[model samples]
Target: MNRPSLTWKLYIGAFYLFLFAPLLVVAVFAFNASPFPSPPWRGFTLEWFTGSGSIAGKPGVLVDPIWLESIGNSFRVAIPVALLAVLLGTVNAWVLERAEFRGKTFVAMMMLWPLVIPGVVLGISILAFFSRVANGLEDWLQTDLDFLRPGLPLVVLGQLSFILTIATLIIAARLRKFDRSLEEAAFDLGASRARVLRTVTLPFLKPALIGAGLVALLMSFENFNTTLMLVGSVAPLPITMYGQMREGASPAINAVSLLLMLGVGGIASVFALTSKAER
Candidate 1:
């Protein structure tokens, strides 16, 4: 095999450094013993990662409760969103790929509109629509509808509006290469449609489904604009971090960011390694 030229090697190294340098800095500061979360590190300590109480020197930090609750809230919203998005997206992909219908192009374009639309706008629209519907319901039914409040369900709805598009695209791409003959053969052999989908179709789409779910989960977790607008009283992790930063810069925020980055990176690495092994 021909070796890469010196110039190409330098470019690749530079590209990786550019991508990873900020993350490296954040990780380093997460362990920094200095009161300030920035440069001029005095020493190294793992207190940030271990402490279960409030952040040192910050009374209102509520590091344990706020951060932990936010993390839970994020997952609570994200997991359901990802699952629902995948189920709906997979069905949409199957229909679009297998069936010839009028206005198919129009339906496809509408499904993709969420990706292009700004998150802020989408959030605002959803909030407005829901608020109107909730008010109508309260007036008509004379009962409070708590689900419309800014919380897990609202976050999931906001996220699913866009995430479903991603899942649809990924699963649809995989479906394009699927052989219809397998399903036909299964039918001829008296296998049920559901059995064929469970045994044959889903296995082929597993990688894409996993990848899409991961993407949806990460996106839901890190989402700021939409979550900010849709979330009423409860705060997710990103919003909490932003509020903390706005109030006053703290190393604890950096520490949390670093830990989250590590968690996400670890998951991605495991997925990659497992995928490679399977191949």
Candidate 2:
């Protein structure tokens, strides 16, 4: 292998710095003793992550009710979104990659349309469509549908709109490379279609499914634009953090950012390891 030139090495270093500098700053600030997440560091302290509100009235991320509730809501939305997206995405992937049908290309394009649309537009579209449905139902059925209102369900649906496309793409990429002979061999051994799917196909797709699910989880957890439009009285972590920043940032926000970084990094690491193991 040819060695990289000095200039190329410097370029790579600069690229990495640009990518990670902000993250490094956030992580460093998370440990800062100061109330604000800025320069002129007061000193090193775990106050942001573990301090009591009594200590200068600055509550830690773990102890703060707002942060806890928002984090919980983010998880509440993300788990369902990831599960539903992965389940539906797997079916879509199978249909797109395995089954032959008329207008297959068109169907695939339509399924992926959510990804091309801006997040704000997708959120607003879902909001409007559902609100209209809710209003019509109220007039027709003489009752309200709370689920149709702006809430966790809507937030989950909004995130899933684009996330489903991502999950489909991930699973489809893996499914495309799957060997059909394995399924044929199982059939030759008199395994039923369901059994083949259960024992062989699902196992083969496990890594991809896991990857898609984790990516979906991360995306759902961090999602803001779509969630912002559909969120109910309770906000997700991103929306909560945005609110805090707008009012005034605290070092606790940096702590939350660091935790998010760790979470996202852990998911990426798992995906990498799973892919490597599968290979």
Candidate 3:
């Protein structure tokens, strides 16, 4: 193996430092034993991680109720969104790969357009469309529908619009390598189409499906820009963190952010390791 030159090593180190310096600083300040969480580093302490503080004369300290509520809401939204996206996306991928039809390419392109469109634009469009639809339904049916109210269902719908695209793409990439002859052989041996799919095709696609579902779940959980616009009165964890930072960044917020980052990083690492092991 060729040894990396001094200049190359320095460049690589600098790149990694640039990438992680802010995260390191945030982690450090999260444990700083100071009144203010910012500059002029003092001794290290873990009190902030468990204690509370008053913000703008509000009698709340340590773990903020609003922040915790938002985090719970985020999980509520993400879990359903991930499940729905995986089910819909996996079916879409299977149909696109297994069936031949006119306009198939056009349909695929339309499905993928969400991945290229800006998140803010997509959020606005979905909000507008839903608003119009809800209004029309109210007028025609003469009844109020609570589904359009700003809450879990709306959040899931907004996220699924884009996250399903990601799941579809990931599963589709793996499907491209699949052997159609396996299905053909199953059919030749008297297996029905549904039986072939359930036994043969789905088994082969399991790993990719799991990986894609996890990716979609993470993306939905961490989403900010789109979720912020569509969240209405309910805030997700990212939105809560943003609000906290805007008001006055506390060490607790930093601790929460670090914990979330570590959780996500750990899950991704495990997924990667398992994938490699399977290969």
Candidate 4:
């Protein structure tokens, strides 16, 4: 076996630093006492992290309704996007893996097509298509369908257009590993197809399904390029952060980042502890 060269180790270290340096900066600045997000640290402070009244000297972010509302809106968009993506993806994965049909390969390719499309282009396409459809409906109904305009649902649709492909691929990969013999045995035992699927197939796919939903949730929350175009009157966390930056806002953004990082870290720690206990 060959060992990696010293140059290769150095390259790997540099790559990791490049990936994590910004995150480290963000985390560090979240505790900076200065209102500014960057440099010449004033002092360590938790004002941003805890929100309003966290520090008596200034208005705290915790009590800021705008940020709180944006976070709430982010969840509203993310949850639905994840659910819709997972639902569509699971169904697509099931059909692709288990059912034989004409143009199956083509159908699979089409499902995956959005993954390759640039998010901005995809957003534009969805907006145009949805608007046209909504307009046509309005023409027939002779009334308004204002909900069809850019907002949470539109953002969800834009994100789902591609996020579903990721979930589909993940679930499909998991499904491919399933033991068909178990499904067959259930059928041989006079189990109806639906019954066998519910008892055996779904249980086998549960871990994958859960994983896909988690991935979709994260992606939907983080999605920006596609979401930016589709979000008109409302904003998600990422977009909210962008707006704050445009206004020359302070380290509250970093504080939000730190809070999110902590949340993710907490979850990971729990999983780690659970795994170690099981082991």
Model 1 clashing residue pairs (backbone) = none
Best by TM-score: 2
Better candidate by lDDT, 2 or 4: 2
lDDT of 1 at 60: 23
Per-residue lDDT of candidate 4, residues 1-279 (tens digit)? 399999999999999999999999999988888868778988887777574654544455566777788889988987997788778888999888989999999998898798789999999999999899999999999999877888888898889889999999988988898989999999999999889988998987776676777778778877889999899888888898898889885788788877778766764565456435432
Segments in model 2 whose C-alpha atoms lie over 4 Å from true places:
1-11
For each candidate in the order shown, give its overall lDDT on alpha carbons: 0.82, 0.92, 0.81, 0.83
CA RMSD of each candidate after superposition: 2.9, 1.7, 2.9, 3.0
**Reference-based lDDT, residue 28, model 2:** 98
Residue 142 miss distance in model 2 (angstroms): 1.4
Model 3 local distance difference test score: 0.81
| Tens-place lDDT digits, model 3, residues 166-185 | 89988887887898999899
- For residues 106-225, could you state the per-residue lDDT of candidate 2 as single tens digits? 999999888789899999999999999999999999998999999999999999999999999999999988899999999999999999999999999999999999999999999988
Work out how many backbone clashes candidate 1 has: 0
Worst 10 residues of 2 by lDDT: 50-59
Flag the better candidate by TM-score, 2 or 3.
2
Model 4: worst 10 consecutive residues (lDDT sum): 270-279
Ranking by lDDT: 2, 4, 1, 3
Clashing residue pairs in candidate 3 are 51-62, 52-61, 52-62, 53-61, 53-62
